[model samples]
Target: MNNEKYTLITGASSGLGKEFAVQCAKMGRNIILIALPGGCTPSLAENLANTYNVDVRIFEFDLTDSQELKKQITLILERFEIDFLINNAGVGGTSLITETSMEKIDQIMQLNVRSTVLITHMLIPHLLQHERSYIMNISSMAAFSPIAYKTVYPASKAFISSFSLGLREELSGTGVSVSVVYPGPIMTNSNTAQRIISQGIKGKMGLLSTAEIASTAIIGTITKYPTIIPGFINKLNHFLMSILPMELKLKMISRAVKKELI
Candidate 1:
C-alpha cells in the first residue's frame, strides 16, 4: 500500500496557483501540478523537485473543455492518489455583459463553475479514501456582491462559496475537510496588475500577495476553517459588505467596475 499523498493544484503554472505549489512543496508534500498545454508546469515541477526534494508531477489539460477534462481527470485519478485538491483555475474580465460574446460567457462559466464542480465531483471518492484529506476552492471577494462589468465572474465565485459551505457540511465527520478562500484583488500578472492599478485606491484595498494568500489559505484549509477571508483588511471588507444594503452595494460596486470598461 502506498502511504504517500499528493497535493493536486489546478492552474499551477502561475500566480496564486504557482504559489500554492511552492508553499505545499515547502511543506514537504509531493505535488501534482495541472495547467494548460503551454504552461510552465514542467520547469516548475523540476525546480520544486530539486529545491524541495519532493516528488512533483505535471498534467496539462484545458479544464474548460468538458470532454478533455473528463478524459484527463479520469486518467489522473487512476494514476495518482491525490489527497489534496485545489480548484484554482478561473478566468474573468471587465466588460459590458452585452458586449461579452456567448463564447466568452461560456468560457467563464465553464472554467470557473463547470470545471471546478466537475473536478471536485470526480475526486471526492479518491479523497474519501484517505484517512484525512483537504479540498480548498479559491473563490473571490467579488463573490460577496454583484458588479456590473464583471457579472458572470462574481456569480461563479458565489457558487463556489455556496458549494464549498454545503459540501463541508455534507462531508462533516468524514475526514474530508472542505474550505473556500475569498481573496481580494491579486496582482497575479501584468494584465491583472494593470487592471488593479487602474482602479487606484479602491482596488488596492484588502490586497494581498499570492504568497500571503496561499499561505493563509493552506493554513486555514488544514485547520478545517470552512471559510477563509485572508488578511485583516479583507475581514473588514467582509464585515462592511455584510452590513450594507444589497441595492446600494450593487450600485456602488457596479459604478466602480464600470470604470474598467474605459
Candidate 2:
C-alpha cells in the first residue's frame, strides 16, 4: 500500500497460486494477491502480513471479467509498485471434446491464455521501470505434448510457454527477466490427488509439491532462466518427448490420457 514494490499473483486464494504467495512473502517481498471474489483472500492476506510482517494486499475479482480486471489493475498500478508478476490463474480438465461445456471451454481459454497475456502485457511496463524485475508464467509438463482428453488445456499451456519464451527474447538484456515454468502434476487437492493416484506410477512420474513448484519457479525466475521445468523427471520427459516423432508422441500421450476417461 505504501511506495513499496510488490509481487502480483493471480489465483492466490489456494493451490499453487497460494504457494507462490507464501514463498514470495517468506522472501520478505510485499505482495498483491488476486483471486475471484467470495474467497478466502482476505484471511490469507492477514496471515501473510502477520507471519512475514510484509505488506500483503488482496484484490478479489474474476479475471474473466474484462472491465473489472482492468479496473483493479489500474487501481493497483496507481497505488503500489509491482516488480514481479505471476500469471498463475489457469484451469485444466480431462474429458472428451464433446463432453466439455461451452462455459468450461471459455473459462479455460480466458483464464489460461487471455488473462495471462493481459496481465503480463499490462505489467511489463511497470516491471521494466525497475532496475530488475521478473515475470513467471506457469505452464505445465502437459505443454510438451498434446494429450487426447486434455485438448484445450494443453494447447493453452503451450501458448503460455511460447508466449513467455518469445517475450523473454524480445526483452533480452532489459533486466526485466521473463520465465515460463513447466511444472509436473501437483496434488493441489484431494480430487486432483485421487485422479493422479488412480493412474498409478505413470501419473506420478513428475509429481512435485506445490511448494516445490512455487519455490523452484521463483528461484529460476530470479536467476533469469527463460524456461524452467521444475523437476528432473519433467526435464527428462521434455527431452525424451523431443526425440519422438510427432505422430508417435501424440499417439502415445493420447493413449495414456485416454485412460482418464474410463
Candidate 3:
C-alpha cells in the first residue's frame, strides 16, 4: 500500500469540487482529483500541483457512468493511498413532479446518489486499512425539506444525508469517520439560488462562495464532525426546521416555493 495519504475529491474540476481540491492541497494533503472528462479541473489540477507543491493526480471520467467510474477508480487505487474521500460530484435538476421526465430523474440519481454509493463502497476496504480515514458526503439543506419545483434534487440530497448518517453509525467502532455537509444555497452553478430566483421565489437569500463553503466542509471533515452545516443562518434554520411541525413547515415551504421559484 502507498504510505502517503491522498485526498480524493470528485467533481474537482470546478465549483465546490475545485475549491475542495485547492483547500485540501493548501493543507498539504496529496490529492487525487477527479473531474468530468473535458471539465475545467484538469488545468486547475496543474495549477494546484505547482502552487501547493503537493502531489496531484487527476482522474477524469463521467461519474454518472458506472462502468467508467469503476474502471477509473480501480486503476487509481492501485497506486494512491487515499485518506479522504469527498463524494461531491452532483448536478441540480428542477421541475415539478408532473413536469419532470423519468430520464432526468435517472440522470440526477445516477450522479448524485448511485455514483456516490458505488465510489464509497469501492473505497471502503482501502479506507478501513488506513490508520484514520474521512469520508465527506455533500448533502444540502434541502435534505431537511420536501422541496417543490426542485423535487428530485432534494430527494437525491436526502439520500446522501441518510447514507452518510447510516455509514457513520456503521463505522463508529472503527477508525474510519463519515461526515455529511449540508450546504444552503452555495454560490455554485448547482444551487437553489438559480432555480429559486428564476422562479421568482420570495425572500430568498444570496449564497456562500464555493471557497467559503468548501473551507468549512474541509475543517469539519478533518475534525471528524459527523455533520457540518456551513452558514450560521443555515445552521439555525436547520435547528428550527427540525423542531417545527411537519404540516406547518410544509405549508410555509410550499408557499415560498410557489411565490419564489415556481
TM-score (all chains, Cα) for each model: 0.97, 0.97, 0.92
Query: In order, how many clashes per candidate?
Result: 0, 0, 7
Better of 2 and 3 by TM-score: 2
Q: Write down the worst ten-residue block by lDDT for model 1.
A: 1-10
Runs in model 3 deviating more than 4 A are 1-3, 190-193, 196-206, 259-262
Tell me the tens digit of each residue's lDDT in model 3 across 1-262.
Answer: 1237899998888888988988988888889988877877668878988888888888888888899999998998898888799999888755577877888888899999999999999999999998899999999888898877777888899999999999999999988999999987754663545655654423345357888899999889889999999988788788888899988887777667665434
Q: Give one digit per residue, the lDDT tens place, for model 2 in 1-262.
A: 3338899999999999999999998989999999998988899999999998899988988999878888999899999898999999899878899989999999999989998988888888988899999999999988988888899999999999999999999999897999999999889878778778777788899999898889899999999898899889988988999999989999988877777777
Cα lDDT over the full model 2: 0.90
Superposed by TM-score, candidate 3 places the C-alpha of residue 11 at a distance from the truth, in angstroms, of 1.1
What's model 2's lDDT at 166?
A: 93
lDDT of 3 at 228: 96
The numbered model that scores best in lDDT is 1
Reference-based lDDT, each prediction: 0.92, 0.90, 0.84
Off by over 4 Å in 1: 1-3
